[model samples]
Target: MAEGGTTLEFTPTWVVAVVCSVIVIISLAVERLLHFAGKYLKKKDQKPLFEALQKIKEELMLLGFISLLLTVFQERINKICISENWLRNFMPCKKPSDDKDEGTTAHFQTFFSPPVLPATVGRRLLSEDSSAPTYCSIKGKVPLLSTTALHHLHIFIFVLAVVHVTFCALTILFGSIKIRQWKHWEDSAAQKNYNAEDVLQKKFTHVRDHDFIRNRFHGFGKSVAVLGWGHSFFKQFFGSVTKSDYITLRLGFVMTHCRGNPKFNFHKYMMRALEADFKKVVGISWYLWLFVVIFLLLNVAGWHTYFWIAFIPFTLLLAVGTKLEHIITQLAQEVAEKHVAVEGDLVVQPSDEHFWFNRPKLILFLIHIILFQNSFELAFFFWILVQYGFDSCIMGQVRYIIPRLVIGAFVQFLCSYSTLPLYAIVTQMGSSFKKAIFDQHIQEGLVGWARQAKKNKGLRKAANGNSAGSPPGAAAVQMTKVREEDALLRSQAKGTEIVTDQRSNSSS
Candidate 1:
């Protein structure tokens, strides 16, 4: 460890452990604070706490992966520099002297010795010449790095970061636009009195039948024909969005919620929505399947650099997380179903709702732990990036680095926390839309049924009046017909009551 302008020394293992423990404690405290604040600010109809926590959890998950990648990237760069002896240029060395002494040998040994610090810290120490070296004579110390190398590396990393940010921005933009389009289509269908289930089933069918490869080639040809062979050729080529691009988008809507009514039988809906697509994927030709596999491999290789080693385990973790979410959803659905059956009602009880909202304690804790670990690592990596350039060194700044890492993590949490209100607003708007559509549909159905029942009753009364003048057998037949009609009306009334109960439950 080192203070301002002091000699660099190996940071004690205990110090590292203590710092990590403190970070974890601080993170947990912040989470609890956010949770309490959300609870305090919650309204009668809102779920501010759940919404805030969910957003934070998602942000942490993303940051964790990003942090791991950046950390690994920095490490790889450090290894390259070390292997090429490029770091030696930054090391403090003694001036060439004619005196042959033990002090000189010791200085040389210390200067050339393998760095005990982690690659990130070692690189930071070397790059940041905040103070004069106190460990060895600095008479022959070289510049940290050549001006050309420094500028090039800095520019390269800056560009890479910019590109990454730009890509993410574009993806979000396109996704939002697609979602808006889907909402518009849904609204149009609702206005025209289309059945929500039918619309969703039709979308699933289209997606299932879509040929991923064929659409790409067809869209490419169409784009080329429209744009012509000119300077815009490549632009048109890449910018040509196909039907296949929309497949996943459509599937997302279908799997997540039904149009008009969001609270449907989600587990069963997912199975039905995915069944055809799953079969289609599994039934693809062998050569095409091989192509798909190769394409996926190539994509993974191209996107992930040396961090693929980390990516493998992260990917596995993601799979596990996804499976856990699925299991939880299924279990909740089963519980809800059982409750409905046992109670002989469509309304879900408050207890069942609580169970749905609050998942198993152990599962939740494990997830939180994973998220916290990732978030801490990400913050530490971010601090390193800020203090030292991507390819720079850290020789004597362990104490400073730890504090900066903690500050960085805190800042990130605050930033995420600030977005809670916006997320809540957006979610509220979506809920309002679903509720509005559901209410309208229900109202129309009830009105139509009421009119039909009134008309049937009037007709039955007219038949009874006419039967009073007919033969005994005819009069008996008319009475029996009225009884059947009454039974049918009773069943319809019961069905309508169930719908009303469901609407009330949903509103609550």
Candidate 2:
């Protein structure tokens, strides 16, 4: 008990370390089990089973958070001592010591007292000799943070680890749900054009091969839509901007007002759209800011934050990775629409340049990777120095460059792992884009609103007129034309009847 009626007790670091280790091991086991179950369900074609598991995992995560909060309250008053003499002077202002032991030095106070470093042990070594200097002889040491704040830090780290894994699982589960919806649409669309009979085979074979490619990239599109990450990009390129008045009204009204050849420059529009979307690609990453705060708190109290900082950026990188996937997807759609004519095989024959690296595209890829991955690493690099005052960890190893280097390497590694397909897809797009640009057909085959609407309107009017009116001619000529069409229809019917008779006779 303190002189001012406050209680102080030492909670062992080894105990906190043990608890953290147990939580980490359990969390990993749970994650691996969930992953195993997910793969099993997927293999067995049990979507409902996987979905039910997702629901259970979500429920468990909630309970875990509740239990974590309860645990925090149970131990909120006890602070764990992790570091000594580090950041002691930088702690917030406190009242001066008024006791007989006022001049006690930090090294003596830390080593001589109960809150000794982790390696120190035994009363024989710690006990002071009567001739030697003691706690009373040295100045008092400042704390890095309030005792209460340190108590809360332990709970924060544990909860952060559990919650991070849970949220990642939730992301994967959401992706799985989207995959089901895509398959349903693909199968339904394909079923419409399927026929077993030969007579109508040509007429019923309406499904395009590129439809498979389109369905596969549906996740890429859905992710962008759900995250609102690249909606504006789609709006500009696809000529589908709803809220932009210049796009919706001015250009549209002018195109409608003049029914002639396009006065609007499609080439300029594509260039501007690309430029606009480029600006929005790497917008502010809010998760980086949250990480900075977490890291600062962890350093102040010497608490083990358990690399939860990397977790947010990992998730963010996944989201950005999903967005980058559009490079492959958009190019596939373009190829399907143009060269394939929405009917042929959905494949791009890559140019010689595509097999070897193109420096410009490589630079763009690096820019995106660095912006998404290294931005967080650099933030933590400087912030660690700010909190610790020294450029080293507790073990006296210089850490200024280690985290940045190690994290950057891991990020680069993950980028390669997560985006291998993305790289190949981007290469395909680059090849296609190069050909399109060389041929001066960058905007070729792009659907336009005004022209297509007019063409559709004309088709509808012609259909209505044909059903409502007689063929335009003298009555005799019109009758003669009708007689010719009747004769042609009779001949086709006769030919079909003869073929049916031949088939019946052969079978008999």
Candidate 3:
């Protein structure tokens, strides 16, 4: 702060980001340890550790709220830097110059003619005579920021992003191929033809079948859910909502909801569902959490360029993973509940309260797309801005270029804040369309399969119609007994008394 050409007054955001990031990092580490410990604990029948794992997961997910803020603000950081540059450029006009020549008027004209941005302003503040620099960076101003600069920045960042995406896309393709090869090496495996829709269907199917591997796969969800919840809790607690009042209101609502329904089971079901979902996505894994922390570490460790781009991937990966997890979990739960109902469990019937709120997990996936697409793109531009300073390409150009930078930053926010919500809505609606397509197939397939199974069972019963399981003559007697029993049950339900003369006399 002291050495920097211009010292910016500490913004509340700085305190929030640093403090929250550190807490999130600690939470992530603890989550990782808990997960690793739980894996071994569950195997070895260590119940206490298993329970602790569950508690940790709950907290971690609750904290993932910070991650959302982190995502929101990381993009804005470059703006702050740029703004400082803006301030520095304007500040030098106030400082009086001692080495005044008759051409001091010429010098003043030269400065005003060149730019009104930080690159030019910064050079004046830090360089003294433009020889060498002492600090990590210098403040500079150029010409007022403009349209050409904005468009140019956009084009430059977009090209870099296109390259980054291309690489990741190639990596995904290569990774998929490797997976196929690995599967082929297994017992009796053969190459299967795949359609894109079918492949997507299968991916969703894996999510659908998540519970089949729940004991193994659930850790991932539990991890994210807890982090998300915890992040939210702290944000509300320390920063905005005034903690104790919030808690009181939360509990009051919970108590009020539980007031009439003497049946706590319904309430329990809703709470459990919320916990499972929230924790699972945000809490159940530490990979992306670790990634974000590690990426920031690189920046703090002196790789200034890493900070801007890294946030994109970290945000994308978390969002995508969270969406996939939530959707699959919900679908899987639905499937399980369907089977449970078929087996005649009254308790498994859908609660009326739940029906109103039970949105499909596909919303999660949609959210990730919204988050990563814009955030990732922004990361690219931010890196470019950082590069603009480091590479010395914007000094003389700064006077011409600073206006564009400011405008672009504002545009970034406007585009993101609006586009993200719109994307979420459209994608979620699209997922609904996809679900309708899949559900039609699933309904037909299951009905047909069930019919065939029933038919096969009937055929087997007929084949053994007189087997020792029934006995030849005894089958008729058994049928007669069954008919009599049905009649008796009907009569009892109707409250009718059969008045046989002998039975009547005995009763009299």
Most accurate candidate by lDDT: 2
Query: Candidate 3 on 1-508: residue-level lDDT in tens?
Result: 3222332344467877898999999978976887788899778754433554565455444445544544454334323333324433322122223224322122122222233243333424321223333122255523332222332334433443333333323332342333233222221211334322332243323322332323212233567557543443333212222222222222222223322221122222222232233223222234433543453333221123332443453444334334423332333244444443221111111112221134545444433233333334445445545634333321223443344344434333422332222222222221122211112234345455456556655655664575567666776665565556556545643332222222322321
Estimate, for each residue in 1-508, the C-alpha lDDT of model 2 and write its tens digit. Answer: 2122222234467877898999999989988999899899778754445565665566466657755664554333222322444634332211124233322222122311224222212222212232333342343443333322343343333344344333333333343333233333323322333222322223322223334343323333556445333542342223221112122122222233211322322232222333222322223234533644655545321232324344545554454455444433343344444542423222333332422244425534443434443544544444334423232232123343455357655554444344332332233233333221111221222223235545555655555566546555544454555556556655655665455335323322
How does residue 157 of candidate 3 score in lDDT?
A: 36
Candidate 3 root-mean-square deviation in Å: 25.4
Off-target runs (Cα >4 Å) in candidate 1 are 1-33, 40-178, 194-383, 390-497, 500-508
Model 1 Cα lDDT, one tens digit per residue, 1-508: 2332232255567877898999999989977886776666454323322343444444455545555564445434333322324443333322223224322221221223332223223333333333334222243333333322333334433333333333323322343343344333333322433344544443322221234322322223446434322312232223222233233223333334433453332222222222212222112134432532343233221132122222332333343333332332232233333432221111111112222244323332332223333333343245335644333222113554455445434333321221111111112111111222234345566677678778778877877788868888987887787678778867877786678558633542
| Candidate order by decreasing TM-score | 2, 1, 3
Q: With candidate 2 superimposed using the best TM-score fit, by how many Å does residue 228's alpha carbon deviate from the native?
A: 16
Worst 10 residues of 2 by lDDT: 241-250
* 1 versus 2: better TM-score goes to: 2
Residue 153 of model 3, lDDT score: 35
In order of appearance, the predictions have TM-scores of 0.26, 0.29, 0.25
The Cα local distance difference test for each model comes to 0.36, 0.38, 0.35
Backbone clash total, candidate 3: 65
Q: Give the distance in Å from residue 72's predicted Cα in candidate 2 to where it truly belongs.
A: 19
